[model samples]
Structure formats: structure tokens, C-alpha cells
Target: MAMAQNFRSAFHGFNREDVVRYLEYLNSKHNSAINQLKSENQTLTDELKALRAQTVSNPAAEAECARLQEENQKLLQQCGDLAGQIAKLQAQMEEAQKNKPLAEEELEAYRRAEQAERAAKERARQIYCQATGALAEATTQVDEAAEDFKLLSQRIATQMTDLQSTIDRSKEALTGAAATLYGVCSADTDSQ
Candidate 1:
């Protein structure tokens, strides 16, 4: 029964974000525990190596062995720290993945903002072109052209106000998305 249960869990790959977070917590705890065990293992191995080196029959061999032992101990200590670092990196990686939803949401929101900006720009272009064309058709010396120019100028002014409003709305949405993105990123960073 226990074996079947273990096998089931092994293939139970559909964990939710919140569940994954809990799994991350458990994994971090396990890594810390294993790291402690590795430290003890390294100590014992270093002691064994030192004992082996000391049993050599030559004085020069003993000196060389002592030097080598010191170097090995330093290397082992470095490895222990690196193991802890590996755990830290693993935790960070899991965290980044967990925050992917917020990042994806920001990406989507930015995409919408980009599309809105493009539409606004297109509208502005069309308005400017219409006004310019009308003004161009009207000659400065012709009364109709002069009158059309003034009207076009007025329309342009109005369109400018519309463009400003569109820009303001876009900025507001971008700002909100930026805030949410910043919150998610900062939360992960603080936890790490």
C-alpha cells in the first residue's frame, strides 16, 4: 500500500501555484537538512584522508600529506558553502516560476497598452492628415482656403485634447500594471 501511494505521488504532476509554494517550502527544508548531513560527511571524509596521509612512512610524505590535507579541507569547506548556495538558487528558481503569473499578466497588460498606443497614434495620424489636406487644398490668398485652415486648426486642437486623454489613460493602466509587477517581484526578492 505504501509503495503504491509513493508511486502515485511520483506521477502526480498537477500541483497548483499555492501547492507548489508549499512544496518549495518543504524542499528548502529538506535541502537544509541534507546540507547538514553533507557537512558531517565531509568532516568524516577529511578526517579519514588525514589519517591515511599520516600513516605514510616518510617524513617528506608526511609534510606533503599535511599540506594536501589542509588544501583538501579548504576545498571541502568551499564545496559545503556551494551546496548551500545551490539550494538557495533552487529556491530562487522555484520562486521565479511561481511569480510567472504576475509577470505574464504584466506582459499581457503591456501588450494591450502597446495596441492602444498604436491605435491612438493611427487616429492622430489620420486626423492630422485630414486637417493638413484640407488646409493644403485651400490657398492663403483664397478666402475658402483661409477659412478651411482655421477650421482645421480648431479640429487639430480638439484632437490634441483627445490624444492627451488617451495618453493619460494609457499611463494610468501602465502604472497599475507596473505596481502589481513590482509587488510580485519585490515579494519574491524579500523572501529570498
Candidate 2:
């Protein structure tokens, strides 16, 4: 830009025509510089407004972000709770596995005891059957023996009666023989 010429005397320094021309030139340059600066300022102000609009948040977006953060925290807490529950269940399963052998042993012992009891009962039943059979056989034998004794007693009684009858007949025959001999002897003596 150019500066305007100033004079203190009428004839001591620059000419009037030269001063007037220099002042006009300076005024034009100044006006052109000011217009260019104003245009640049306006462009810069527009860019700044656009930048502020991009950076600023709407109310709905801000609320949505807050809600999403709260939900994320709740999900994280639930995950931790599920992990704890899984760990507890795993420990219980391990404890049950440890006791499995003992439980099986006890079950086996009970089965053996039940089988032994059943076997003993069967043996006792067999013995009882055998004893009943023996008793029946003994009773049959005793009955047969008693029948034989009765038959023998009857046969002995019949034989004794027959023997007594034969002895009485023999005695009567001997008495008749003795009477005949005595009559003969008495006749001979009388004749002599």
C-alpha cells in the first residue's frame, strides 16, 4: 500500500499534481487490501461454524451412549456370576466322583449279604424237607412192625389151642389101656 503525501509550504517541497496522484493511488490499494481481508475472514468464520457443528452432540445420541454403557456393565456382572456358579458345580461334581468307589463297595457288600441270606434260607428249607421225609418213613415202618406183631400173636394163640387138645386125647387113651390089663390079671388068679 502507498501513503499520502503531506506539505508544510506551498513551494518548498513536492509538487501539487504529484501529491494528489500519490494520495489517490494509496487510497485504492488500501481499499483493495481491506476487501480481500474481509472475504478471507468470512470464509474462515464459515469453516469454524462447520467444525463446531460436527463436534457437538445431539441429546438422543448422548442418552443412547449412556444406556449402552449401563447395559454393558450389567452383562459383565452377569458373566461373573455365571462363572462363580460353574465353579461351584464343578467342585460338587469332583466330590461326587471321589465318593463313587466307596458307594459302589457298600452296594456290593449289601448284595453279597442278601445272597448269603437267601442261600441260608434255601439250605434250611432243604433240611426241613429231608426231616419230614425221614419222619414219614419212620412212621410207615412202625406201623408195619405193629401189624406183624399182631399177626404173630394170633398165630401163637392158634398153635397153643391145638397142642392142648392133642394132650387131652392121649391121656384118655392111656386110662382105657390100664383098665383092660387089671381085669385079665384078676380072672387068672381066681381060676388057680
Best by TM-score: 2
Model 2 scores a C-alpha lDDT of 0.65
lDDT of candidate 1?
A: 0.71
Report lDDT per candidate.
Answer: 0.71, 0.65
Q: CA lDDT of 61 in candidate 1?
A: 63
lDDT of 2 by residue, 108-137 (tens): 898899999999999999999999999999
Prediction-by-prediction clash tally:
1, 0
Candidate 1 runs further than 4 Å off: 1-57, 116-192
lDDT, candidate 1, residue 166?
A: 95
What TM-score does structure 1 among the candidates reach? Answer: 0.34
TM-score of each: 0.34, 0.46
Q: After superposing candidate 2, which stretches have Cα over 4 Å from the reference?
A: 1-65, 155-192
Tens-place lDDT digits, model 1, residues 1-192:
222233223112423454455555556765765666566667766765766766558777667667766766676676676667667757766776786777677768988999999999999999999999888766545887678899999999999999999999999999999999999999999999
